[model samples]
Target: MIRHLVLFKLNEGVSRDEERVVAGVKAFQELDGVVPELTFWECAWNITDRPIAHDFAINSAVADRDALTRYLEHPAHQAAAARWREFATWVIADYEF
Candidate 1:
């Protein structure tokens, strides 16, 4: 099995207001394909003073590597990604167990 995890940070000068962020989050949930088993989260913790730190802020767990690749290549995901690119930093990792 494969495990795909991701994290995101909104841009320094472009913090999304709570409402917009929530909307975006929901929009992501509504994506129609390339996701089989998935989960997401939004950050609510204060972690501004730590180094080597990345809270699992804005995360998704894809069920497998194929899903991860398909998710990235999906048209709907591409649209959302274009929007996110302007105001986000992201990390993705894949693991096997």
Candidate 2:
């Protein structure tokens, strides 16, 4: 199995309550049932105010590297990411379990 993690930090001056950010969050939250390659999916906002913390996170799993690739390349995933591109930057990590 592969664990795919992503952490997102909103761009300076962007707020979570903004229309675009709200829409972006909803888009990602709706991906669980929309993407077939996802064996597991969890996404949510960060709870802490620590300086080192990211504003949002995605913790998901797939059957394998190929599955991970498909999940990453899926059109729905791409579109959701594109929306975030307008207000946030993110980092990702993938590894075998």
Candidate 3:
């Protein structure tokens, strides 16, 4: 399986509770039902106050690289990512499990 993890940092002045941010989060949360390639999906806001901690995270798994690709290309994921791009930057790590 491929484990796909991501940490998102909100842009300066962007609040996690902002309407658009909340909607974007919801969009990602809704992806598990829409993407067939996903074997696992978990996402949440981070509560830590540490400087190195990101504002949110996503932990997901798929069968392999191809499945991961399909998940990335899914319309719902693209839409959610685009929304996030307006107010945040993210880092991702993908590894075989």
Candidate 4:
């Protein structure tokens, strides 16, 4: 399987309670069942207070590179990601396990 991880940092002055941010989180939270290529999906807000910690994260897996590609290209995933773009920036990493 391929593990796909994403870490997000909210834009300066952006609050998690903002309407758009809440909607973005809700959108991602619903992706697991909506994206057929996802073998696993988990996402949440960061609980740590450390400066180095990201504000949000997504931990997910797929069967292989092809499945990972399908997940990335899926319309629901694309739409959720687009919503996050309005309030945050993120980094991603993928590795086979």
TM-scores for the candidates: 0.59, 0.98, 0.98, 0.98
- State, as a TM-score between 0 and 1, how close model 3 is to the true structure: 0.98
lDDT values, one for every candidate: 0.57, 0.97, 0.95, 0.96
Candidate 2 — worst ten consecutive residues by lDDT sum?
A: 63-72
Clashing pairs in 3: none
Model 4 error, position 7 (Å): 0.3
Lowest lDDT sum, 10 consecutive residues, model 1, at 37-46
lDDT score at residue 49, model 1, on the 0-100 scale: 51
| Runs off by more than 4 Å, candidate 1 | 18-22, 32-63
Residue 38 of model 4, lDDT score: 92
Pick by lDDT: 2 or 3, better one: 2
Query: What is the lDDT, from 0 to 100, of the residue 18 in candidate 4?
Result: 96
Q: Is candidate 1 or candidate 3 better by TM-score?
A: 3
Candidate 1 local lDDT, 1-97, one digit each (tens): 5555556676666555656555555556566334444443233423565655553244455656676677678777777667666666778777764
Candidate 3 lDDT score at position 31: 93
Tens-digit per-residue lDDT, 1-97, candidate 3: 9999999999999998899999999999999779999999999999889999999999999999999999999998999999999999999999998
Model 4 earns a TM-score of 0.98
